[model samples]
Target chain A: MSHEIPIDDGYLDMDLLRFTTAGSVDDGKSTLIGRLLYDSKNTFEDQIEAVEATSKKRGDEHVNLALLTDGLRAEREQGITIDVAYRYFATPKRKFIIADTPGHIQYTRNMVTGASTANLAIILIDARTGVIEQTCRHAFIADLLRIRHVIVAVNKMDLVEHSEERFNEIVAQFKEFASRLNNIVDMTPIPISALHGDNVVDKSTNMDWYEGPTLLYHLENVYIGSDQNHVDARFPVQWVIRPHSDEHHDFRGYAGRVAGGVFKPGDDVIVQPSGFTTKIKAIEGFKGQESEAFAPLSCTITLEDEIDISRGDMISKPNNPPKKDQLIEAMICWFSEDSQLSPRSKYILRHTTNEVKAVVQEVRYKVNINTLHKIEDDKTFTLNEIGRVSIRTSAPLLFDSYRRNRTTGSFVLIDAQTNETVAAGMIV
Target chain B: MEEERHSYQVNHLAQLESEAIFILRETAAQFERPALLFSGGKDSIVMAHLARKAFHPAKLPFPLLHVDTGHNFPETMEYRDRYVAELKADLKVGLVQDSIDQGRVQEEKGPLASRNALQTVTLLDSIEEHQYDACLGGGRRDEEKARAKERFFSHRDDFGQWDPKKQRPELWNIFNGRKHHGENFRVFPLSNWTEMDVWQYIKAEEIPLPNLYFSHDREIVHRNGAMLATSDVVVPQPGEKVETRTVRFRTIGDMTCTGAVDSDASDLDSIIQEVATARQTERGTRSDDKRSETAMEDRKKEGYF
Candidate 1:
């Protein structure tokens, strides 16, 4: 019965970030995540007495903290934030996970499904409407989802009074429209006030002439550790344990999750579209072996020479491999609200733990996302559209280049007759 | 930004236990009647300890289901029968008093009566009596506000409901779990966990739980500001009084609307220091999410987990 408990293990040195915000219900982005979870105490007291009794039964004169991350019931009777919600918060250094997408111009496939596993991207911008067009379509969907750390924020800044010349004219008009976002890699900007809690989670005593670092200290100091791809190894095989047991008879192993570089225990690897190689033999880890395993560690390995890997195989690193393809080209994002993208259509694409049977074959242009241009005459694609297509598949995929590996460069499509998930590719 | 960029990172509870062991090995390589919904709670005993590290030496390729709500807490039925007989795994219960003596549900009647929404008709009648195309749950999109619009692969139809405006858009850790023809799929590999990352991953996986989550004395009954626990399915009205007190629960659901609190903070590092200074919300002492404000989005659009 050890009672002293001040609780240390300091959350085992806390590390996890995952960002993605976007804007539109008046760009406060749910009042900057309800002022960073109510000034970082992580909002409670019966969720602020049920958002102050639904902001005093909607007569509302304050206390709206975007009615605390809005949620369902037709988005709290339509105040907005229609889908991607995922909030969570933490502070003694880190643990965030926001995702909160949705910024109207028809949700753009919920901001490309909350910028696919974001390693940062906040966006917001409303400091008295400076970088509009929904802030260049939220920095072009955080640069078409390669999202390597963004932020921009600039929110209300107490309705532009704590100015700093309108926060350096909306951070030089959002770095001249996010300098045509070539896969971001750190943008930053700040100046907050999600309803007078300026510089979010403490710092702006009315902007002491704006000295920076506060949207929770640039989201608890963002480096996003080279946003993953420790250097090409991969992994894909999702499951194949085979215990056909008698206490320990021929165990087999493979399992998955590493999805990119650094894999060890003998390491020669290769397996992909059945290229074969082998070596690893013992990385294991559910509380055992593991001499190494990387990118996103969920171990198991064990090989040494029995190849024939399964669940859409792809163990990698033979000579930095990955890119087997079968006529691809990507950059998609449609997300079907009752379907449209034409050409040869087909679908069920999936990728990573692979799935195949894809068709499409051309439509290659769309972009316009708030003038990042290239509309090339509306190449018919519907629901939240963002184009460049060219598909083909029915086999060979194991890839990379969502700017080099966001888990073997992403893929989604599905809808081979309404199995839904419609579109969100990337690879190009 | 340099402790050499926190040296190849990984911590947040080992990247949420390697993204819940990669969505439980992508629900054991995408369903064929998948199950794991179990509720011996601490998020399904840390989702059956990450489904025993997601299929370790095999054996759990499915069954743990539970749905029982026959008002639990006999120390969660002896820790769900000694942890499903120490993970030789495969349990399956489903009762809710056999969906209320087979009328398929109808019991809630009075002084806060609650079969907690009759365990969603015995969990959609045990996923259509096991036609179960994937279930998995320990749902944690930081516990409700309609589970922060959950979706680690959540889709459900052929009647097990949940449509939070037609979900299906989860990208990247790519999870489509395609379905139709008596469809299903709940999945939530602890959808990005956070009840302080499941009490710091059950205090870094020492994971044992059920002594009704520490601090105990019992009796209880303060109501509406919460504390309730006077179980025998919580009967204590007419100007309530039953004291005893030290109390403890903070979410295990259904000993009549689960709500316990007073605490001495027994172990698991003083219950993660009383859940990091608890300010009410582990479902704010959930009396089934205190009835409404879209009560957990109308019990997740009628397919309540």
Candidate 2:
């Protein structure tokens, strides 16, 4: 089966990019992902054959690309996506992970879940229905999650005759609304027709007035290597690897993924909550010794002196330590249907690798996702509601502001009774 | 922009490995009694290798559990024993034969009968008997459409049922493994990995796999547009003729349902190339998924990993 195609060594150097897609109902979100996957040669022939057969059975005119993403039986029967479905594809330049999420009012939690770990977000806008409330809601969620890059794909441009004026009008409307968002570093608007494959993978001949890169080209070339916070070094120790064998009797290494900044051997560090200072004696990679470790890399660090470090403790630079506080304010998106969040409600707050009992002290305000307006009078939060609240924990939590570092500043509230995740929080 | 220039940059494979290791470690730290569900397949082998790397210089914290359907290929069983013995880890087996003997499950009767679906009862019962809180699987989203919508931390009810509509929203790297008594989680560290990524990683890391994955001369019977291996458990029916062909198993499962593809790829590089240019999905060869469009979904909802 081996062919004569030249295999380049550069193929092993491909990087990864994770992005989320959001749009209103019938906004062609799934279609865009399906087309991107199909054009990139990711979709298999059997998958297409299944979709084609289903489409013909359901009396569709063409092979419905949207059927590729609607995975669940209910979703396929109803012809809608109700949950976050992850899709994977790769090109010569990069490997892409798309978090294809729903864009309805009831599925805001799905969008937030998809956007939580994304480096970039793609918000689809139908050119016929320029910018609507659903667009604002998606943008607000993307901004609140602190997504750095956003691609405003104005789809269905062929329906509007590929009018540059229409595309510009939609872009202008998006910019007007985006002015209120924070932490949005870049927003690139591309005119595309996902159904017709126009300006999606290749440039469309119908839209000669548009002079922007194609969607696939932009996705492949976008730079996202500098997205992590590399200034404040923080490593939340998840486990302590102790090889009690005679071969390595003295092995006591801290195992964790580097949450923020860079860590190297011989760096002065402090253990959070314990307030003990130590120096890194060595760093262990999967195979051998590593000189340094950066954000998102999982490694083990052996300290110069053992100071009683365990799981849930953090390691950071002594000069710049995360704030340790019991009372913290954060913006939370409610994700529970069994109960509503109110004052005096107790739950288990999981921050980083630490879990502690926390009580809601006060509800400052709730924001209307459609308009991004604050509602100070609403003291109760139900499912899919976003609000700012203060919580007092049983113990002091070592954390940074979500604006500074996403890894250290995010948390989830788990209901101790039902053992279900009730809300997602970002520390302020 | 100038400050973005760094001396080192991790590639996609390295990044994925780190992510999987992180998840594996998190499961070890969070769960009280967890077990790795080993199927002796390529994905499980890759996962077991990652687990070894995650806790170097120390034995695995959890044991490996294999739900035996009594219809596995001999090569897979041989590979399973060798791998487990080399790791020096504990191994537990849940046999479907025992379930049938105890009157806990009934066997299907037909020419196309498979013990694949019957393993669910044995699996859930084993979890109950062992009180395993977390069971790590090698399920990848790219394998099936239902799996694409599954979470890395999939929750199961007290009755051992998965409610696809009521899944908890997983955010960032924070996984909620909290569960009440009798409830458990099915953790998949390789949820984000694709088929190509697995093969590439295996080749890059020089991971060992079963000989069944490689092409070999075997007696096969073409049935229902699929080439099935003629094993002791799978006998050829009347009008079905067995022929010798050079074939390889894309996925290993119950011999009755698992199918083989005719190919000539004998090595890692050749197999990778074959997978890259392959027209059908890995699961397309398996006759189990041909039962219905949502067969995997139905099985998954009933606690099938």
Candidate 3:
């Protein structure tokens, strides 16, 4: 057997796309991921052989591709995905990271964790069942996490006779439900059969009436350039680079990933909390002085003035500085199974390289994820529960709403005593 | 076409590099005493390169700890010494032989016996002796089934045991490095990188590797359907014939368990092409993982990197 190099010299120019899969249980989520890996030639011979042996041992007809995932022993024995399993595959055009998360309702935290860093989300809908409660919950979490691109894959189309009518009906149903979400910028629906490999990697010949790009095509060509916050200039200083060497003496640079907007030499910036204003003298990148630095680029910057700035300090434009306040209202997903979130619960909140002690002032309401309704009376938050809460920090936090900037708007709460990450919060 | 590629739109290599640099800087800022777990392998070499770029002009804030198995290829050891000197960073070596001498671990005795599993004890002892709250590993999720469920910031207990079922939910780019005393975390900067990505990045960055990775003629013996080099640690077993063959290692591990594949691709481009067309996973030739179906999982649960 011969295989072509799916990539070439221009492979270095290929961009990366991180996405996550979400939907109801038994929707063939894992199989869709396996099919993607296999059809793309990313699956190796040993992995295939292993899966085949497992399938044969389990007495299954046709190789069970889902076994390729489900990495844990218990997960494989139970034939289910328990936690998030990250898988990587690359075509000549782009490199893709797939966060295959479990779809059980009790695994809401898994979906939230997987969706946190995803640039896009693939929500699988069973062609026969159409949209269900789990589907809405997945869409809700995706929207809440502010994922810009969403692909509504109407999977298992082979079971529905590859009917164009069924695909359209499911797309319509998803759009109607997704209309309530405000953060999703682009949503494309495609009919696919994850098992039979229809319109996933290659276009489906059975569904001739459906005329859309295959799932792989859309993934490779999606417009993700505008997904970042390029309008707001925010830099959260993560580390201070002082070489302490004679050759680079008198050099002090604030190093951090550009959280938002474009930063350039001579740009006027303000240091939060201290309210010190300074001008950027130079942007020191590894290659040398970069003309401009934008969101997600890790670079070091030197200021014109010798202002004392340390980790967790936010640098933004004076014209549009981030909101500075001690009281924060946000929606949080409870992730701790050992404890529950109650009023007056103290935790260490970390946001944008800064850490602060915070107290849960009040739990306003619990969100019924399936129905997207507020349960006002049930304010307690347990494991896998999400709710709106008000928190008061010991020190003021600089930020924007999660809708505006994902980096500056997100934070994680660590249990003070347990040191475990208990909640993931998005500033509202 | 050139104008279409915006500055904000970074390529996959640059993106992975940036992510790694960010993680490195975070590790520096979070941990009081952190160390990079260097194995003189390609992954750790790439990781050290990233660390250099992360804090340019400034020496690496942490030390590079190599848990020597005492059965390594000579080229790897030489490369480790030279690379450490070039970076001007601190180097710490934990020897499995020392662990054996100290009666902490017993050496296996057989044709298939290897010090591969014994390195875990030495590694844990080094972490404890050095009080490293965080150890940056070159572990990538695509390398093994157990690694697929790994988080960027993987937590460990006081006994250095990993509880996969009880991992903290890592969200976005914000990592929680807060831990109690005696407990440490294993941070993987290349958790999302695949073997192809690693090679592509190495080629793009022009990073150098040990000579063992290139094709060369070596005496080898066949065992368990893999080509094992006839080194001092791994000699010919009874009824096994030793032959000279042109081969190269897909991965760098202990000389006892690592297997070389027949290949003529000696350079970066050809090696990448070979990797692209190769029918086996990079770890497929590793005898350590071939021991059982869930060998990696079991070892990882026992605090293996």
Per-residue C-alpha lDDT of model 3 across residues A1-428, encoded as one tens digit per residue: 00111235786678789999997888999899999999989889999999999999999998988888869998889887778889998998999998889977457899899999999999999999999988998999999998989999999999999998888888888999999999898999999999999999999999999888999999999999888878889999999999999999999989889899888899999998899998999988665677777777788899999998999999999999999999999999999888999888999999989999999999999999889989999767899998899999999999898888999999999988989899999999
Q: Mark the regions of model 3 whose C-alpha exceeds 4 Å error after superposition.
A: A1-8, B1-7
Q: Worst lDDT window (10 residues) for model 2 chain A?
A: A1-10
lDDT for each residue of candidate 1 in A11-73, tens digit (9 for 90 to 100)? 755778888888776777887788789888888888899899988987899999878888887
* Candidate 3 Cα RMSD (Å): 3.3
TM-score of 3: 0.97
- Indicate the docking level reached by candidate 3: medium
Task: List clashing residue pairs in candidate 3.
Answer: none
TM-scores of the candidates in the order shown: 0.36, 0.97, 0.97
Cα distance off (Å), candidate 3, residue A358? 0.9
Q: Tens digit of lDDT per residue, candidate 2, span B170-253?
A: 999999999888899999999989888898888878888999999999999988989899978888999997899999998898
Q: Rate the local accuracy (lDDT) of all candidates.
A: 0.81, 0.90, 0.90
Residue A426, model 3: lDDT of 97
lDDT of 2 by residue, A1-428 (tens): 00111234576557899999999988999899989988788889999999899999999997988888879999898888878999998888898899999867557898899999898999999999999998998999999999999999999998898999999999999999999999899999999999989988988999888888999999998888778888889999999999899988999989988899888889999998999998999887656787788887888899999799989999999999999999999999999878999999999999988999999999999999989889998799999999899999999999999999998999999999888899999999
Models sorted by DockQ, best on top: 3, 2, 1
Scoring each candidate complex against the real one, what DockQ results? 0.26, 0.57, 0.59
